[model samples]
Target: MSMFAHTETNARSRLPGGKALGGLLQRLGLGGRGLVIAIPTLWLLLFFLIPFLVVAKISLSEAAIARPPYLPIWEWDDGLLNINLNFGNYLFLLEDPLYLSAYLESIKIAGISTLIALLIGYPMAYLIARSPENQRNILLMLVVLPFWTSFLLRVYAWIGFLKANGIINNFLLWTGIIDEPLIMLQTDFAVYVGIVYSYLPFMILPLYANLVKLDQSYIEASADLGARPVTTFLTVTLPLSASGIIAGCMLVFIPAVGEFVIPALLGGPDTLMIGRVLWDEFFSNRDWPIASAVAIVMLFVLVIPIMMLRKAQAVEEGAS
Candidate 1:
């Protein structure tokens, strides 16, 4: 009754010669819930769905000498629309061992990088989460301080540090650790280092968020039960933070899979990734159709991990 009275009063409070906004919204079939849902639906349709459709269309087309450099898959002839899709692009990708190797190598690199990030980030996140309240903020700020610098600048800075005559080598040489400078730049080592450095924060932040909210009573109960720290962590803390691990791994792995700059700049000729292949096909070879196909394939490849993450999240939510 009170809600009804409030609604009636709201409807009656419109300015002179003004339509009731709530009634107008109701007439357009857009209540609060409807507006919230419709806005995001329209946004996805306009952006993601539409762009994916464009890419899918181009992927079905053939390479041409025209300005856009790709032939349309659909055409009108004799007042009838005709569809002519060239599946050769996909066929070519299947037949090419290079694309297959690149895709596999990309997955391998991303997976390895994600694991390394997790190994390094988990301890840091744990420390921060367990830190005294007075010092936690400062530690967290330190963890995130690297982001204040430009990412490109940070990557370039690593080049200076990893080069043959770079700071690392100079320091080592001065200390008589080695006579020759280490071959760090333009190697798989450099690529791994770059990926770990760049994505470490991504891994840490999620783990911290998960860890900070963990119940201390669980740890205390395990201690009272005479469990060692390692056992307690493995049996209790680790299980509780599984969601963070999944979240962090997904965050690091997804972007790392499609990373171009890190591999292009820090990796050697042997370190061929799908991202580099896509870049070469599009800009270097001017094969827009093939590039679109590569992109589509990459999108499909990423879908599995994304679905797994979603499933994990759903299970976690249900359990909670």
Candidate 2:
């Protein structure tokens, strides 16, 4: 009897849940691949899609003097269901020229910052990628060293450098390059400088990753074919690193458009950005509907560029 019981236990262990769980999964058409895909899908649904839907709902509601500060979109009246959705919040945005100017200015600033980062980062990345094996790790570490320090502290340090009678102007004055201090603080130029400094690593890391993997043979062959250095770079290296350029630009531009701290601290009143406007709507004015509308529009604007970049990257990969 003990031997029979032991044999039964082994059989049950081999079969697991007696094939019930396996049969259930098979009937649901959920294989190992499906389970793996479900993780990210579930994550997005929880964190991204759910929050977006909530904001979207708020955007369609009317502002009110209540606990939530927005009128409910639906109500019950005489046993009949009634639904109310307010789109005036969006229309009001179009009617207001301030919002338009804010959007345009944000795009302009972010675009310029991305361009500056690319120009500065490309050379640094190329140098690091081409450096000796012993120095490569150290160079990469230096590139990311800024991240170890607090981001806010770094921005504050920039303030000290850019302020009148600060480090830069003082140095210039001492060198007799200028008789007086330069007005560098609270300006658009200061905003650009701060953004490029903060996001330069994002640009360089992608470029270095892409450039390091590039085959030396293509470059050598080009040089062998009587191509000059510039010609070889323009034809071979540049084309191959297009993916990195797109990725880095997208990373920098997206956050820069919604940047608030750098602009608020470094930029003057003239520096109009959507992020600032959103803050005002949400906090100062306490207009939840308008703020939600502005946020939704901004998301759509950023999404368009992201979709375009992704499509471009896909085409590039397919061609390669």
Q: What TM-score against the true fold does each predicted structure earn?
A: 0.87, 0.86
lDDT of 1 by residue, 125-190 (tens): 999999999999999999899988888888888999999999999999999999999999999999
Relative to the true structure, how large is the alpha-carbon lDDT of every model?
A: 0.92, 0.91
| Per-residue lDDT value at 234 in model 2 | 99
Q: How many clashing pairs does model 1 include?
A: 0
Candidate 2 has an lDDT of 0.91
Worst 10 residues of 1 by lDDT: 13-22
Model 1 pairs whose backbones collide: none
Residue 79, model 1: Cα distance from true site in angstroms? 1.5
lDDT of 1: 0.92
Give the best candidate by TM-score.
1
* Prediction 2 TM-score vs. true: 0.86
